[model samples]
Target: MRLTQHDATAPTGMRNNYVVMRPQNLSVGVLPVHDDGSVTLVGQQRFGLMNYSWEMPEGGAPYDEDPIDGVKRELAEEAGLAASHWREALKIELSNSITDQRAMAWVAWGLSAMPIAPDPTEIIRVTRVPFGDLMREIARGSVRDMFTVATTLRAYHMAHQGELPPCLAKAMLASVR
Candidate 1:
């Protein structure tokens, strides 16, 4: 990441110099859900936050590459799982005022185990929590990663609003109650 200074006019017609952070690549987040309404999560110490965080598997993708490809790799590498189904959950700009980091998130199912291959810098712990339990933790502030939080909430919305498959949505909603 790098910061670049730019001269810009504010909404109030004031001119000022602003330093903006530029991220190198687009990022992707995946919420891997099982047939039983459990979701896979990866836990690791975040360097920027200096705290241990549990988040849905997420990673960066180059601008020239399909974000789905990056999501597949992240799921396999961080959670040791692969999905036969995929659905786009959200596309968002994170902290848009400070950084130009955009992310795409997906809800993946039809999960099967794969070989885990984490990056050399990552010491990740993998876990599967029920959908409802995950939501509870998020509300309680234990799971604080924005990507994960957003994706999970989107998935819940999908389940309720008929965006997700009926059977899968039923299972997911059942877990919540």
Candidate 2:
């Protein structure tokens, strides 16, 4: 992350110092759902926070790479899941006021087991939980990552609104009550 200060005029017609963060790459996040309506999450100890966090499989995509491909690689490396179906769930600018980091969120189903191959520096624990349980965890703040929160909520909305495949939406929304 690079931070730069620039001379700018505020909306109020006042001169001000504006600081901006320039991020090098865009990011992608995937919410992986199984046939039974379960979602897979990854637990990892974040070096910045020195605490464990549970979040959807997410990673940075180089400027030249497609975001979907980057997220598919993340899903395989972090969760050991291969998805046959995928949908764009959200597109967001993460902390836009401070940085130019953008992210794409995806919902993936039609899953199959695979071998995980995470980066050597990462130690990730993968878990599959019911969609409802995952929702509760998000509501209770156990899952605090912004990418996960936004993507999961968007998936829930899509499921409720019949934006997903009928069978998949049915399975996903069945546990709501």
Candidate 3:
């Protein structure tokens, strides 16, 4: 998509009361769970007044990287885990005070948890919790990744219904917690 630019005559940092078109950033997120039904999440690099959220690892899909490749890279770079299989779980467009971008959230199953080697540029702490507690966290507002919530919920729903949408693995991931 073409990102329109303005400043037809505006100063730096000023929108000149014009249409300040925000560039859409395409990104990915992981909703990782283990065989024992435990989920892996993280403490975001940034903290909020409501306390840092427990969200899955996520990142932007680089201009040169395919969505799956970008998500794999993010998984390794952020959560310190890599996967052999990744599925798109849900789609969402998050627009609020903190971010404005299109996101694709995913679920990486048959995972093997190992040491995480996150990029120095990222500040994250990988965490794990029981799958049964997931809903509880959501209810308590502890799990912040909205995409994570959506993906996990959808995953649980699909688990019972058999199979999933073809885009089951292609998702829009986000949340504000």
Estimate the TM-score of every prediction. Answer: 0.97, 0.96, 0.71
Q: Which wins on TM-score, candidate 1 or candidate 2?
A: 1
Highest lDDT scorer = 1
- Residues 1-177, candidate 2: write the lDDT tens digits: 689998999999999998998877788999998888889999999988888999999988888998888899999999999999999999999898777889999999999989999999999999998888889998998999989999999999999898899888887777766
In model 2, pairs of residues that clash are none
Evaluated against the true structure, the overall lDDT of model 1 is 0.94
* Clash pairs for candidate 1: none
Candidate 2: segments with Cα more than 4 A from true spot: none
Clash counts for the predictions, in order: 0, 0, 15
Model 3 regions more than 4 Å off: 1-24, 47-51, 96-100, 164-177
Per-residue lDDT value at 168 in model 1: 90
Could you tell which candidate, 2 or 3, scores higher by lDDT?
2
Write down the lDDT of every candidate, Cα atoms only: 0.94, 0.90, 0.66
Candidate 1: residue 46 Cα off by (Å): 0.4
Worst lDDT run of 10 residues, candidate 2, spans 168-177
Give the alpha carbon lDDT tens digit for every residue of 1-177 in model 1: 899999999999999999899888898989999999889999999999799999999999988888899889999999999999999999999999888999999999999999999999999999998999999999999999989999999999999999999989988888786
Q: Comparing candidate 1 with candidate 3, which one achieves the higher lDDT?
A: 1
Candidate 1 residue 162 C-alpha distance from true site, Å:
1.0
Give the number of the best model, judged by TM-score.
1
